[model samples]
Target: MSASPLLDQLIEALRCLPGVGQKSAQRMAYHLLERDREGGVRLAARLAEAMEKIGHCERCRDFSEVPVCPLCASPARETQLLCVVETPADRLAIELATGYRGLYFVLQGRLSPLDGIGPRELGLDLLAARLAAGDVGELIIATNPTVEGEATAHYLAQLARQHGVRPSRLAHGLPLGGELEYIDRGTLAHAFGSRSEIPS
Candidate 1:
């Protein structure tokens, strides 16, 4: 049972997205062909356009349509405080928590030595330089509670000490190895409120 050439190609491409299996891709592909042909074209066009237009922020490496992201570019956001996390979604979680009013620096990914993601890959060197230049006051580590996340946080805390600055990791309560994106607002807020310094 083979799909038509065009349908098979569509299915293959869409399946590249996370959580989208062959069945889901086939369903979506048929839906696009039968009902949303123009809509599908528009979606593809918009995706391409956004990819071309958006780049990483100069300051925090968050996705940006401009050189700097909205939060980093805005003058009103607190410049002294910094929240470091693995992805933009993690940043969104802190925003949802509603307690952190400061700016953020997104690592885009966390350190995993087994996976070959190291300090240079995570941009800790860049962060160290930024803090040393007196660009921030306190660095709040909001990375997830997974093994790699904890490793990354510990590494950053140690790096900050060499620069004579202190770093703090979020307090326990996020469920061991849990991600920020899935946490509820109350729990996230409590984590932020009760954050403890990563011991030197």
Candidate 2:
């Protein structure tokens, strides 16, 4: 432990961040104290303010300072297409990588019974309500290609069908420009199974 109790507490606090171990936390604490005290103060203030003010968006459930996020508030976004993502990060990834102009419904997490994350935990009820409103024609399931994600996708598809909304999954297969030999067996198998005919 450090000589200063506050410093030790700071190191422990830094360790709370994802992938940050004891050594990394200690290093960060030392750097903040020695080299970047002003930066550290700014970081602390902003972090505190964010924790206090940032909340989930009412419509999309993404982190927002306001009730409805800017994207959901925008009238230009396609109301007929509602993309379902596992997290705000995933939504951001889609927004950055694709030309998708549709709205979103952030699940926050996939259905993991063992972890105590279920339909209610992921806000599926809210999504169901939105689907039932009949504005969304398509529910784009953009969950990750994991076992839990697949289960979550299946559940979402059922929910969409119940509401008469067409459900579509993000095509999972091979990455562009990647060689077949370098790809994993599961990916290769999936790609082969999902092979589509070349458009004339």
Candidate 3:
């Protein structure tokens, strides 16, 4: 235990961050106190402000300071195509990696009955309402390639069909530049099974 209770508390608090263990937290706390007190103060202030002010967007459920996020409000986005992602980070990755001009609906999490996460928790009602509004013609399921993600995608697809919207899943297969020999068996099998004809 540290001589100072406050120092021990600070180290413990730092451990709350992902992948930060006791040793890493202690190192961070020492670094902040000994080398970057000003930076620490700024970080604390910003973190506090963000925790207080940042809220989910009313339409897309992405992090926002206002009722609707800028993406949802922007007219340039395609209203007919709505992409559903499990998290804000996933949404950001798609925005950065793709030329997709569609709007989004953040699921926040996939359905995991074991974890008690359900459709209600993931805001399916809002998505259903959006689909029923008749603007979206396609619902793109961008959930991860996991059991929970697939289950969620299936449920979303059914929901879309009920609303007369076409449901599509993001294609999953081999990675670009990855050789078939080095690929995992599951990925290889999936890629082989999902192989499409070459364009003329």
Candidate 4:
């Protein structure tokens, strides 16, 4: 028998999200319809509101419906030291660790040439402009240690040199190919404490 259009529509729409396959989508749709209509509507409404309002920070490229994120808005966030990350999730991880009092620059993505994400697409030019502003004294490259992460770090290091800013990278203590989101708070703190200067 054919599924009704409304149920199928939500399942199909949710499947567009990463890793939510047709099976999981069907399960979610059923749960929403059968068990949790109020919860489902709430989730859908909140998702819509956030998607419509949240946007990128013009300065550091983090999430900000406003002109700047709350962190960037704070004058006490040690703007002299900027930590570069690949996504907002990394920011949450670093925030959880709490040793990093610096501002952040989210690349928004990595160097995926196959995916057509180049330096320009990753906001490297805007980063270059920010570095040239002379407000920052140090740059911490906190991209994960995957192949793409390493490439992104290398690219940022080169750009940092061009702008005459000191750049550093987290020490290789975390496991290879591991994400910051998975690393524990203590380890992340230690990594921040022992960051090494990027060679010129």
Candidate 5:
């Protein structure tokens, strides 16, 4: 009448993922153990690999396997133009959706004082140092349209001004309260293309 210990453990572990409830976790556990053992093994291997190898980029703070991410190391990317994003996923979405060839500064998270996340926690000090280094000419804030994201963008904009760099925010194509990672490619591209200057 009781499930095996390993099966129960797998189901519980799956529930740790966002939006996955107990029922969904049980279904996934059964699907993986019964119908797709090989796929399950591959997933386990990949997760282990990523967990062990992935670390934040020294310059951009995005997840990377090396000191710097490939995009940051690329000579083709414009060093003078920097895009600010809330997470590595958001940066990836913008890169895939837009014609942007600039460097990026991943905040790793946004301001959430209630949750105890602030400028120092998001590596804003490092960003300010980079801006003040004078290699960057512009900062494009591509944070999500959420309240926390907006506050983060505004704070970064102030930092940009203090460092004498131009500041801008993504345009209106992205819907209000929408996260950048969930937006469609076309809409993201339009928003990036029509980005407006933020007086700083």
Candidate 6:
């Protein structure tokens, strides 16, 4: 039997989340209704609040309520050292694993021509502008080891060279095709410690 209109809408809305299938959505909907209406209401309110308030940081492209993220606004961070990564989560992982004091540029995604995600889509123009300002002396690429990530890293390395900024890549201790967020802290620390310069 088809679900009631409200139930159907709730299930569909839940499915909008990544990796949440119909069954999972249905289960979540039911669980929320059955055991935790208060939590469900809070979740809905928080989602709405986040959607209304959270936006990409002007400088780093990471999620932030203000125009600039805390990292970009911080005075202690090394502004001359820049690290590029696929997402904000990767940046957080790096922060947790290593003592990297550099500033970061979050791509929000990697190069994927088939998906129509090119340089513009990944905010490379904004990054290019930052590099052209000549503040960044060295760029460290910490994108995942996936094929698309590799392509993005190479492209950014070229862009850095064009702006006279040295480019480096995280070491190979991170397995091929592995995401930075999933790597162990020890491996991530090692990778950051052993990062090598990309040949211009």
**Candidate achieving the largest TM-score:** 3
Instruction: List, residue by residue over 96-142, the lDDT tens digit for candidate 3.
Output: 99999999999999999999999999999999999999999999999
Pairs that collide, model 3: none
Q: For residues 51-166, could you state the per-residue lDDT of candidate 4 as single tens digits?
A: 99999989889888898888989988888999999999998899897688999999999999999999999898888999999888899999987899999999999999889999
Runs with alpha carbons beyond 4 Å of true place in candidate 3: none
Which parts of model 4 have CA positions greater than 4 angstroms off? 1-3, 174-200
lDDT score for candidate 5 against the true structure = 0.92
C-alpha RMSD (angstroms) for model 1: 6.6
Candidate 2 lDDT over 1-200, as tens digits, reads 67999999999899889999999999999999999999999999999999999999999999999999999999999999999999999999999999999999999999999999989999988999999989999999999999999999999999999999999999879999999999999999999999999999
**How well does model 2 score by local distance difference test?**
0.95
Q: What does candidate 5's lDDT look like per residue over 56-90, in tens digits?
A: 88999999999988889999998999999998889
Per-candidate TM-scores read: 0.81, 0.94, 0.95, 0.81, 0.83, 0.80
The 10-residue segment with the lowest total lDDT in model 2 = 1-10
Clash pairs for candidate 1: none
Give me the overall lDDT of model 6: 0.94
Question: What residue runs in model 6 are displaced by over 4 Å at the alpha carbon?
Answer: 2-4, 174-200
Each candidate's lDDT (Cα)? Answer: 0.86, 0.95, 0.96, 0.89, 0.92, 0.94
lDDT of 1 at 78: 89
lDDT of 1 by residue, 82-129 (tens): 899999999988899767778998999999878888888877777988
Q: After the best TM-score superposition of candidate 3, give how far the Cα of residue 18 lies from its true spot, in angstroms.
A: 1.4
Instruction: Report backbone clashes per prediction.
Output: 0, 0, 0, 0, 0, 0
Clash count for candidate 1 is 0
